[model samples]
Target: MTEYHGNVHVGGPVQTHELPQLMITKVAVGPMDNNAYLLRCRQTDEQVLIDAANEAGTLLRVIGSGGLARVITTHRHGDHWQALAEVVERTGATTVAGRYDAEGIDVPTDELLDDGDRIGVGQSTLEVIHLVGHTPGSIALLYDDPKGPPHLFTGDSLFPGGVGNTRGNAENFTSLINDVEAKLFARLPDETWVYPGHGADTTLGKERPSLPEWRARGW
Candidate 1:
C-alpha cells in the first residue's frame, strides 16, 4: 500500500494506517469535509466506526457485509452525525456519544461516555477523555499501542494548528484551551498521533510549540 499521509479530500482515495493489533481507515465525507474513521481490530475482526459524518452509501460500502459493532459520535454537532441514524439502522451498531451531548443527537445513545471510560473493540480498547467547551460533551479517544506510538481521535476539541473553534465565547475558549493543555498536552508524549474530525492529521509534537500562539490569538 501507499504511504498514509492522512491527507484526503471529499472525492479522493481513503487513507489507512495499520498497526500490530488495529487498522485505522480514514475517509473524508460530506461537503464540509468531515472525516470518519473506521477502526478494525486485527486480532478479533471486530470493527467500530467514528463519526458516521455523511454519505451513508459510501460509508456502508466501506463497511461491507461485515457491518460494524459500534458507532461513536464525537459530539452533538450536526455535521458529525448526518449519516449516523442510517448507519446504525443498517448495521445495528451500538450508538455511543458523550454523556452531556447525548441529548442533542436525534438518535438515542446506547452508551454514554465520561472521562476515563474504556470502550472495548473485541480485544482492543479505547480510553475516552472528556473535553469541554468545544461543546459541553466533546471527547477525545486515546489508543495507546504497546508496540508503537499512541493515537488520539479528537472530535472537535482539537486539530492540527490549534484547538477547535469555540464560536467566539471567551469562557468556552478558555475552558477548551485549558482542558486541551492539561488533559492532552500535559499527559501524552510528543510522539502521539492526532486525528481530528476534519482535515489532515497531525502529531502532538508538531502542534505543541504553537499552543502559546493559539492562546494569544484567542480564537
Candidate 2:
C-alpha cells in the first residue's frame, strides 16, 4: 500500500491528498478492492466521486454531509461501478461517463464525457482524457496543480507496473499502448501522480522507463 499524506484504513476514510484548493479521500471497496475517490474543491466545497465501486454504506459515510456534484465512472466495466446506482440514487448526484461506454452501464448517464472536456470541482477543473482500448470509452481525469505536480486518475487504462489488460488481443494492447504514449506519456510531465481503479498509486516518473518492457511482455 502506498503511504498517503494521512492515516490509511481498509474500507474506511483515508485522506490521501490535501492542498490549499483541493482535497482527495480514498476508500477501497468490493471484492476486487476497487478504489473510490472523493475529490473536493476546498474553496467551493463542491466535490466529485470517482468510480463508486461498491460498499454504498461506506461511501456514503465517507461523503458525509458534503454535497456530491457528480459521480464519474472511468469505464463501463461492472467491477468499476457496482455501487454506482445505489450511490447516485442516494445522493442524487449527476452521473458522468464516456459516450461510447455509457450505454453499457446499468445506470443512466446524466452527462456524456468526451476527450478534452473539463469538469469543475469547486475552483479547480479536471481535464478529461479519453484513453481507449481498455474500453471503448475509458477516460482519465487530469488535475493540474500550480503548486506542484499534476494528479491523474487513470481508471484501468494505466497502472503502476504497466497498462491494463488487453484481454489477449494484440490490437487492443497496441491501441492502449499508443493512447497511453500519445495522450499521456508524451505530453504529461513525469511528476504526475497516477491513481488507478484498483491497487496502489504510482508516479509517471516511476513507470515511464518500463514502457519498453511492458510492450515487450505484450500485456
Residues 56-80, candidate 1: write the lDDT tens digits: 9889977888769999999999999
TM for candidate 2 is 0.95
Scored by lDDT, the top model is 1
lDDT of 1 at 61: 79
Q: Once superposed on the true structure, which residue ranges of model 1 sit more than 4 Å away at CA? A: none
TM-scores for all candidates?
A: 0.99, 0.95
The digit string of per-residue lDDT tens for model 2 on 18-126 reads 7667888878886887888999998888989999888888888888898799999999999988899889888999999998999989999999999999999989999
